[model samples]
Target: MSQPNPSTTPFKAEQTFLAYNQTQAKAYVHGRPDYDRKLYDAVLQYHTSTNGQTDTVVDLGCGPGNVARALAPHFTHALGLDPSPGMVESARAQGGVSATSEPIRYELSTAEDFGCHLSPPVADHSVDLIVAANAAHWFDMDRFWATAARVLKPGGSVIVWTTGELRCHPDMPNCAAIQTALDHMQNTELMPYFNPGNILVRTRYAGLVLPWQLETPVPEFDQKTFVHRNWDVGEGFDNELPEVDLDRYETIMDTASMVTRWREAHPEKVGTEEDYVRRCRRTIERLLNEAGVEKGQEKIKGVMQGAMLILKRV
Candidate 1:
């Protein structure tokens, strides 16, 4: 008998992709998070060591071209690829360069489907390095690995990294407490959204191998995972939350408001915004209690810490 589908919520990839594009994505790029420059430097070093020179790098699952924009200076050429058209547009708008300057191109394509998208796809053995920043979760590892091998030249390598929350951000203690309380609730009451079934575990399988035999591992290839700690920085306040006019906070609130309005408009997208809102309010209340935020206090602040794994293919 054929195996039953593991997903219960009718896994329509296109819908999820579109929803991300329409709703949750901008917040992801703006609030999702950024990486430490040290990590980027280390990745560049690895690429240089492998190829003896770093020229062209490919950013797989490059949302908004954030990684590509960061690595552009280190390479002679860089390309950011993603399947979300909205994300591609955002990346282009943010990272687009003038014609006079060397440009980094952002294209829309899935990790496995790049073959069809790249008319004259990256020539075999041309790319010195391939980097997927915070995007491996959506990929099919086996096929992705095979495709990378096909495009990379001998001595080239692929690097995949996951960027999670910035638990260490000085102003994230409140956030941490909120998560703690939510965790407790999840373990006990276990709401439908917070249940184990709600968690989606995705991975990026990175390795170096030849094109002809996808299963055959390439010699001299090695892989290591790097642990990165991020500070919430309140979207860039790494050392501390910088003092600013109330408008800045209002802007953050505005983003939240927009998300709420969007959620309300499309209840089907977020799946019962009422429940999510209730959970969020409860989480905030628990966090306030944990942080000793007084009822009359005008504002509250706290800190958080989290980790990301970096894998080097060779």
Candidate 2:
């Protein structure tokens, strides 16, 4: 398939192809919620539980290589694949990695485009584990499953998870307003690419079965689904480390939209783009205040809650 121009706005097809690039990849590494230690434990346990030959692990959509960093120690080799150069860079920086190692390696490539780009990429039926952190939504699941099947060793497992709506404390008045906007965004066409649940189930319409027809189907693999909540009201309780400002936040949101940032990058529209960014910041400020976010605690809006579903390849 011909790749879309990176300079252009993102449509549905374009969105799928370029969802994880430098811009979103950068924010994704820093802005996404943390996966609980238990999540990592579950991953390790799944691999260990299956006394087969589990060695190499591939983290599809491994933004910033966060998941790879967590699993690197356990696996003989860990591969973090992504489409965004910026994200791959961030992953290399954060994942305590320099180049490819036994437990960790970062690649600037997409899961869908993995084999094509890799000169001698993973061989057929050679990989023991495959994972997609919060990024599987961007993949064509049928193609992804087929690709995974070709690479996974017999009895190898694939684990993919997506978080659910967050439940935060009511003290942060701004939380409610921000949440409302988030919910609204979800309902609108704006967030179709962001919702993992919708993306996964809907892939069936594309003639993709849920891993059932694989040569080694895992119909009854370990499944854990639940509402996960979180509360962190104290000061300095930031999610993305080092703490970025509202300006950075604005750039990320706009870049994610691609439509919104086209003007920003064009010199002729600088004035208009600046105004739009200001308005967005103001709107966020208003929503945060409505949610009980105080003047000094503008960052409190960063706190969040989420749910996770783990699908282990049996």
For model 1, how does the per-residue alpha-carbon lDDT over 22-58 read when each residue is reduced to its tens digit? 3445765654335656667767776676553567778
Evaluate residue 284 in candidate 2 and report its C-alpha lDDT on the 0 to 100 scale. Answer: 65
Off by over 4 Å in 1: 1-15, 22-25, 96-100, 164-178, 185-278, 286-291, 295-314
Query: What TM-score does each of the candidates earn?
Result: 0.65, 0.64
After superposing candidate 2 on the true structure, give the runs of residues whose Cα lies further than 4 Å from its correct spot: 1-28, 89-103, 165-168, 174-178, 181-209, 213-281, 287-294, 299-314
Candidate closest to the true structure, highest lDDT: 2
lDDT of 2: 0.55
| Candidate 2 lDDT over residue span 75-134, tens digit each | 777788877676777777776532245436788676866555676777887777787765
Q: How many backbone collisions does model 1 have?
A: 15
The TM-score, computed over Cα atoms with residue i paired to residue i, of candidate 2 is 0.64
Question: What TM-score, to 2 decimals, does candidate 1 have?
Answer: 0.65
RMSD of each: 7.0, 7.5
